[model samples]
Target: MQQADIHAAAQTLLSRRLNNRMTGPLKAECRPNSVSDGLAIQHRLLELMTQQGNPVGGWKCALPIAVDGLTDVPVVAPIFSDSIYTTSPCPIIADEGWCKIEPEIAFCFAQDLPHRPTPYTEQEIVAALSGAHLALEFILSRYLQPDSVSFIEHLADCLFNQGLFIGPEISLEQAFQASTIELTLTTASTPEVQHFAGKHPCAEPLLPLFWLVNFLRQQGIDIKAGQQVITSSYAGVIEIAPGDYFTLSYEDLGEISLAFTQD
Candidate 1:
């Protein structure tokens, strides 16, 4: 199919979300032929989605988990303002009653790295960061069958992001202190108190931030002030099941709790 046809199809697919979307339609529809085309479609999808009033609040990035055993570029996508929440006593459905909780560190920018003639360096980008916070990302799949989808399909779908839950802000310096942080995940409903001696997979959390600055520049997108960017997952995807209540402690840094209910 042509690029326009592909874009329109992708938009429709994204708009419909999981409703009326079947797994069998994967091989036969809306596949972009190249990365550029796919990314273009993704931009349009974001535009269309945001036009509905859910403005872009921030972004979430994750290193692609080698689709089908083949290496793929990292995926970055806008996080809508409506879905982002400061963790509280509020209720969250987690979209379809299930959500993948990825404990991560998110950087909030204090200065805008606007579209510039010269690229923003790692040092400049670092200086612009306002603070860091402990976050739990909620994964939302655009396709009915995520595994049956292709690489570009995954890309255009924004790497299965639904939303993010960020806790109280902390100093950037304080965030760095937990470089080799120990994490404990405990749920009252289960006997499991899983402990992880976690370290940023990239050695330092800011490494991804540095990469993201350049990546956005390459894509001709500006990094806005006050916009938060979550680096990547420290503890892969942890699904929240019914009656599940979790307390994730990050060594000496801090901790956050999540309570999940079927209601």
Candidate 2:
């Protein structure tokens, strides 16, 4: 794709979302000849982030995990912006539509990880993490082609990452000694409001991170120390309609809730 194409695609998907258009086929447009293709796409976005008039914040990586009722393994495509907010409920309009809201936990890094390096052990990975928190990440995307299949395609199309509402921080070790926790997601809503609950996927959430560290290493990309990683969650995707209150909670961790109108 061309630079203008990248920018235009980013803007359209950012404003409208990936599901807005019904593109015909789910074909792989971005050739994943090398892992750098994906990383390069990420870097391109990182560069674009400077337009926000601030330094690039931390990293947020999303992985897909199983949920009880949701059969389609919806990719947990999330975005990260650093220190944008702290310990409070922030609001965002996802897809300019009323039915979609997201809440998640995020990790902030005090140190930077290698841009590229060899296989990393769990010890090396744990040492790099700085803190954790319950955050609200609004995910938006539009289908360039029918199937939103390519992870790289999503990367190219802005990773369905549009905005984030962040909160307080906690040490990674404190949450789970082994750097992972299992998550459970639940939601409740009255005619007036709705909320989604999330927790570690297993007894440990860090397992996904550990798995991701290896995945990245195998792909030749190094997860820097200061980057943020969001392990997968079991909360099935919740749809938000207009004029409703929404809350996403991570039991014992934190809660990210918000309210919005259809207009």
Candidate 3:
């Protein structure tokens, strides 16, 4: 895609986010047809958001998934600073009267890992972390019919991320050991508590961070100090009504509680 096309696509996405609205896929002239094109649009979107005062605070990433004969590259999206909440009663723009959330572990960096030719080892990546935290990723797709769009289109929109809620910190050892957590979810609006043997898609949360650091460096982007990285969800996505207080407990690790109010 040309720079103009990239800007156009990014502008459309930024507009939807600012206006708290959703639309169909981008127009043909500005649509991304490849991973590179999608990433270009994503980069442009981040620039636009930063220009509007919502700078990139962190990122969300997952290991690649293979299906049939094709394998996907790892997925990534920027998490804006303005969207990360450190307190409860988190405000959100609900989709149709409901909100979607994902439970995950977040790793915060203590130092900058600037772009380099050499790959960052797992130990080096871990050494740069300040600590781990329990987090909830708020989801809100810009596309009205998300399923109708291509993977590239979804990628360009930061993989449906709307915001993030950072909760309590946990030990690095505890975070590493949390591959398979027995999850229990309780909500104030419902009597029944939901339980699941939550499993991380990549088995370990740090796997994606290791990949993310290396991937961004290759793109001439640095993993700056204080930025948090949230790996793939452990218990998948859960839908809850607005105003419902919910608590997610990860067996032996930690728990986070919050309520989503309509923005």
Candidate 4:
């Protein structure tokens, strides 16, 4: 297929995937084999999303992942403001699209790191963040077997993110002082609870933040003031089953809960 056709088809697929949040395998033709193709598709999808009037309020990012010994660049994408909610019993799914919960940390920027010539220093990046909080990223994929999707294909799918839920804020001092968290993930319908200890993949939680600052600038995107930056998940991925009431308690940071109706 021509490059234009590839982007157009992928954009349409992404629009449907976001509009319905439907759970199923993606159409084979929309899959892109290379990261360059995926990036082209991703940006086209972003444009399509904005044309629909959903403003970009923030972004979610993760460290680079090695796929078959070749390290993929970090995953990054805009987070729609409407999709974000404070800790509450919010409805997650209805007619379609499955949700995955990932425990994570979020930083709210106080200063805008607009496209600039000079690279931002670690101190500059940290200073740009006004506060920190615990958050659960609500992930969704067009593919039913998301895990089986190729790395490039997954990157094109907005890194499998659908929405974000931000908990109460914690002081930056408190945030940087800790590196590990004791997490408890609970599903209300089954009424079962599981506990696990998880830590930041990077020794310093701010490493990804700093990397993101520079990364965005390089891409000609800026980290604006009052916008949030959600780092990678701390705990592993947990797919939200039908009728599941989800709650995540992060050690010392606080907790957030979401209630879902079965589709």
Candidate 5:
């Protein structure tokens, strides 16, 4: 398909908050020759973003395969100007014509992701962490359609990544070494707090750093110097509605509270 065809298709679907249909021939129409080609289109879209003057500020990472509790996918998205927020008690827009709050784990990088190969050693990832935060990622999907959507599609669209509220920063050393930590997510309506509930597979929650870095490297996109990388949520991506309050605690890591509103 022509770039305009794809662009128009994306615009129509996004405008209606719909998912693209990937049917027999339609699938062939939307399909890029290869994953790298798909990424090229995404980059071109980012380049055209300059004409709009709101450059992508950074990036947010997601575990597309992590949904079923034990899977992994290599995809990340640009953190647009409108999506970056100061981590504090804040508001988030939601679907269902409203807004809701969500608490997440976020990481910041100290240096650029080196141009290299996959299976980046744990040491390389550890050395890159500049900061960590108890964050709130506003999880909004384009729509609730599965056939037309896939993990890779979300990655290309910044993973439907709308906005993020970040909290105070701390050294990765502190976040990584902490063991038996508790994470709580709460809202005004619920007495319960969402918890991390399990130990991070590695010593650090920043493990996804290496995974994402390697993913990008394979795609030929350099994680330039001074760019921050927000790792995927180890917990699940829960749905939210408007009028919700949320909080997350990481014991020594820190605590974050957020309120929500609708667009």
Candidate 6:
């Protein structure tokens, strides 16, 4: 796609976000037709957001998937500074009276990893982390029918990331060793508890960080200090209602007690 088209698409998406609204696919002339186009739109979207004073605070990514002789590189999106919360009840824009969230672990960076030609080793990557935390990734898509849209379109819209709730701290070692977590969810609305044998989609949570740092480096981007990076979710999306208090227990690592309120 042309640069003008990319900027136009990003502006369209940003307007929807600023207005707290959703729309169908972009206009044909500016729609993303490839991964590169989607990434260009994302880059422009970040620039537009920063211009509006919402700087990038962190990032969210997943492992890469291959299909039809093409690799859909690990999807990535910036987590705006204004959207990250440390306390609850975290206000959210619920869809159809329901709030959606994903349980994941986040690692905060202690130092900057500047762009370089040399690939960063796993040891180097682990050494840079300051701490780990149990986190909930809030979801609210900018598209009307998210499933009906193409992957590129979703990628351009930051993968439905509305915000992030950074919960209590956990041991970095424990988080790294947590290949499987016995998760339990209790809510005020129901007496029954929801149990899930949560498994990291990539087996190791830090693996995606390793891939992400190198990927960004190759793209001439730096991993700045104080930025948190969340890998794959332990459990898929879970829906809860507003005015409901919920507690999520992640095995023995830690638990997060929070309540959801209407945005």
The per-residue C-alpha lDDT of model 6 at residue 251 equals 87
CA-lDDT, candidates in order: 0.72, 0.50, 0.89, 0.74, 0.58, 0.89
Query: What does candidate 6's lDDT look like per residue over 156-227, in tens digits?
Result: 889889999998899899889988999999999999999998999999999889988998898788899999
In Å, residue 198's CA in model 2 sits off its true spot by 4.6
Ranking by TM-score: 6, 3, 1, 4, 5, 2
Off by over 4 Å in 3: 66-70
Instruction: Report the C-alpha lDDT of model 2 over 1-263, residue by residue, as the tens digit.
Output: 55554454444433343224534222234333222353444555455545654344444454443433433222332244542455333444445454454455666656655545566677876777777776655554555442434555555554555455565565576555423323333334554433334444554766666666666555555555555666543353456655555555555555555554332
User: Compared to the true structure, candidate 4 yields what TM-score?
Assistant: 0.86
**What is candidate 1's CA lDDT for residue 41?**
69
lDDT of 1: 0.72
Worst lDDT run of 10 residues, candidate 3, spans 65-74
**lDDT-based ranking:** 6, 3, 4, 1, 5, 2
How far is each candidate from the true structure, as Cα RMSD in Å? Answer: 2.9, 6.5, 1.4, 2.9, 5.1, 1.3
What candidate 5 gets wrong by more than 4 Å, as runs, is: 1-28, 31-34, 62-73, 87-91, 97-102, 112-128, 144-148, 178-181, 190-204, 224-226, 239-241
Model 1: lDDT of residue 167: 79
Summing lDDT over every window of 10 consecutive residues in candidate 1, give the lowest-scoring window.
18-27
Point out the worst 10-residue segment of candidate 2 by lDDT.
Answer: 24-33
When summed lDDT is taken over every stretch of 10 residues in candidate 6, the lowest stretch is 65-74
lDDT of 3 by residue, 147-232 (tens): 88887788899998999999999998989878998989999998999998899998877888999999999888899898989999
* TM-score of each model, in listed order: 0.86, 0.61, 0.96, 0.86, 0.71, 0.97
Query: Per-residue lDDT of 162-256 in model 4, one digit per residue for the tens?
Result: 77888878889877765788998787767678887777787577777888888878777778898888877777776766666777788767877
What is the lDDT for 59 in model 1? 88
